[model samples]
Target: MANKTAPLTDTEIRQAKAKEKEYNLGDGKGLLLRIKPNGSKLWLFNYQRPYTKKRAVLSVGSYPEVSLKQARQTRLKYRELLANDVDPKDYKQEQEAQAKEALTNTFEHVANLWLESKRDTITSGHFQQVKRSLEKDLFPSLGKKPISTLKATSFITLLRSIEAKGSLETVKRLSQRINNIMNYAVNYGLIEVNPAQAIGEVFKKPKKKHYPTLKPEQLPDLMKALNTASIQLQTRCLIEWQLHTITRPSEASGTKWSEIDFKQKTWTIPAERMKSRIEHIIPLSEQALALLDIMKSINGNRQHVFSSRINPKKPMNSATANVALKRMGFRGVLVSHGLRALASTTLNEQGFNSDVIEACLAHIDKNEVRKAYNRSTYLEQRIKVMTWWSEHIESTSQNHLLTTKKSRLKVVT
Candidate 1:
């Protein structure tokens, strides 16, 4: 019959004394307390490697710091790992290495890599906006966190903090952006599951809003307001340019002289300045060319077609048209962006093709192949569409001006 080894107790451990040489007191099953001649007691777990069957020692902890009960728990865990064909010493080393790697591969580290990947794909203006959000909103909160170790709750807490500040719009965007970064990590195999995938669903939804716009019949009122409004010529030209070109405020305001082609009668907007991140070719009408001639006399030498009043070297303020619209009694009634809707309504009412009108506005398409196809496919038709819209504006202003003058003539009698 085999004899069983007795487990060491706290009383025996406390009484263990250092001798001339280091000695061990066994607590059975390969766990022992080593009392060194320097008067320190250390806990060691000696075991045989599972596959190799070689002897190995795992440092459980120091004695007084790790109580007998705690050391026993660790021994049980290590024995379970060994039973499952894992070497305790090797497993410990692997766990330590993973912990170290997690600390180095922080949230900010992975996010920056993901952000850099999107740089060339999106516009420079959009890239900077994304980078600023990372630094200002996301980074200061969870930037230093190890992405692999982060749970869904960690992000939920962040969203709640952002929501508490009453910036629901910011909260909504950051939640999606954070999830996108996590998705980037998942695709790269940095982590297994995306912990932030469901966090956005837990937050309050923001209200949907639309840009202020006008109906088709109200076109003459807008034209009359622009004609007599006490605004700068540059501002009026900017408003007219955007309306004529069917462009966004930023796209029209940031137009460079190099983008114009007098012979071709086209305005080629680069992909970097466009919201869709796709290069757009706008067919210019006679009215559009006339407006350009006026701008040429005012700012032909300057870099931008509509240069800033304060700094001619820079583009005009993007908000200048919106301000002008408000000043022309279109406040809350129509905005700068609403100019696109106004033109779209008038064109659609005039029986223009819907796809060609959308293409003129540079609306993003869900199908990548079709989007590329439509750009060239609709260019010829778009020329007539733009010309019609431009002439609509020109003739509307003339009719309104004649009416206003005739009314004044009758009042004089």
Candidate 2:
């Protein structure tokens, strides 16, 4: 028959004095409080391996920190593991490893990993924007939380907080980014579901606001103002290049000298730099080439065609053109992007082929098969159309100047 041991009480444990040598007070079922000669008590659990039946000891913490009742409970827990054929020491080690992994798998950590994976796939400016958004808006609240623990309700509250601040646009953009991150988490098996997948439906859609633009008739006045405005030659040339090429302000601002081809008379923006993630070829007109020649003479040695004056190594600020337009008293009336709208309107009105116009605008074709088959379907027509457009602007600007001179002469008479 097995010997029976009595359980220990808190009073009895406190009353028992330490001896000259280490001794144990039994609390039943392999739990013991070891009293040392130095007047310290330690709790320990002795158990046998389920498979090997080998003896093992597990520390349950020191006495006073771990009470007699708590020690007994821990021993009972370990006995339960033994009953299930699990070794207590091995189970404890697995729990510790899981705890460490949970600490390492925070949302911020995974989000950074996702960003690093996209570094080569996205432009530096775009990556900076995403990083800034996360640092300022999202990271403060959810960054430290485990990615697996995040739920739909967590993001719902986060987005609603952004909405409460009247940043509907930010809320929309943040929701898309969050959904992307969640999807990334799912793809990597970090989580079972994308919690942010359906969160976008909760936000109210923001009204679209088009960038204010000039009518075709207003181009002459715009051209005249640009000519007479007291701005830097580089700024004037940048604006002229944007108008002649019909490119986005960012594309124009970020243009590098390497992107241009003097022999081919074309500028090819890389897939990563373009919004559509497809390479864009801009056919250089005589006007565009002349402007490039002048720019080359001034900043030919620099990497960026439109390098910042303060930091020649970096591209010009994306807002430089817009701010210059505003300074020239065209803030509300026109924007730098307005040039694209003006070009599209004028070309469409002139009955240019829609496909050719779309090609010139670098607009992606919706039909995947067609896009793959005819990537440069309207290359020849685009070159002709761009040349014609540049000539039109030149003629219109000269005519407006002539008309102004004649009116001044009449006034003098």
Candidate 3:
């Protein structure tokens, strides 16, 4: 008959000294305190495989780090696995793997994955905005947390912080992004629910403010001021091109020489450069053609029509036109984007067809049915409208200049 060993005590473990040969101090069924010859102590579990019934040893942890009570608790867990016919070694390996995966499945990790998946679908500028928003706002607080642990309240707190900064629009946008990332996690089975779905209910809706624009009657003074402003001619031409073509500031600044067709009298902005993600065709007026001729004389050799003076390899800064407008004493009166509103309102008031105006502005049609068939529907009419608009601007500026000269002569007399 074999002698039964008693369970280990804390005092016995501490008092036990190492010998030349390492020995095991049994703490009953399968739990042993291993004292090595070098005076190091460790906890080990002796177990049997249910299938083959082979004996195996598993290392629980270093002694004292894993106390005697904790070692016994672990031994009980292994015994429960044995009762269920599971191999303790295999179960431990599976648990370790799951723990590692949990660490890797962090909120930052999934957000980056979602961004990478959309890289080819979104424009570089739009992609940069999303990346910056995540890095600056979302990533700092919740990045290290596991995605599965994120709750709706966690996201609401994050959004409210952004709202506190008076950036309500940014809060709305960031919330939508968070909802997208959570939905992505749900689709992959990493999480069961999207906590961000209900976050919008808590935020205050952003107030609408129209861009400051010059009225049609105000166009003459603006044009005169632009012409005489102490700015680079390249910048002056950029502002004029934006007005004549009614393009966004980004579109004007990013124009490349290759996009212009002097023979066709047209400039074709590619889909990647357009806000609507659709290609836009602008028919060049004689005025626009003359401007291009002058620009070609100066920048035809460069890639960007409005190439940066400091770095010829890149496009001019998108803010160049707006800064010039501000410098010309139009800071609160008008902005670069205000040019679009001015053209749209004036043309609509003048009884131009709404469809033609929208097409010329490259505005996306909201109605899905009409959008399917109406792309490029107003090409001929747009050509005529653009010519009329350009000629009107030139005539307005000339009339303003003549009127100003007369007023000056009257004062001199």
lDDT of 3 at 213: 93
Candidate 2, residues 36-90, lDDT tens digits: the string is 9988999989888998999998989898998877887888899999999999999
The model with the greatest lDDT is 1
Candidate-wise lDDT, in order: 0.87, 0.85, 0.86
Stretches of model 1 off by over 4 angstroms after superposition: 1-5, 161-168, 309-313, 398-413
lDDT tens per residue, model 3, 1-413: 98899988999999999999999999989999999999999999998889899999999999889999999999999999999999889999998987787689999999999998877766678889999999999999999988978899999988887899999989888888998999899998887888788788799999887888999988889888976789988898899899989999989999998999888999999988887777888999877887788788888999999999899999999899989999999998899999999888878877888888888898888998777655746777887778777776776675332122211111100
lDDT (Cα, tens digit) per residue for candidate 1, span 281-357: 99998778888988999999999999998999999988999998888888899999999999988888777778888
- Which residue pairs show backbone clashes in model 1? none
Residue 375, model 3, lDDT? 72
Q: Which ten residues in a row have the lowest lDDT in candidate 1?
A: 404-413
TM-score of each: 0.86, 0.85, 0.82
State the lDDT at 373 in candidate 2.
48
Give model 1's clash tally. 0
For candidate 3, give the lDDT. Answer: 0.86
TM-score for model 2? Answer: 0.85
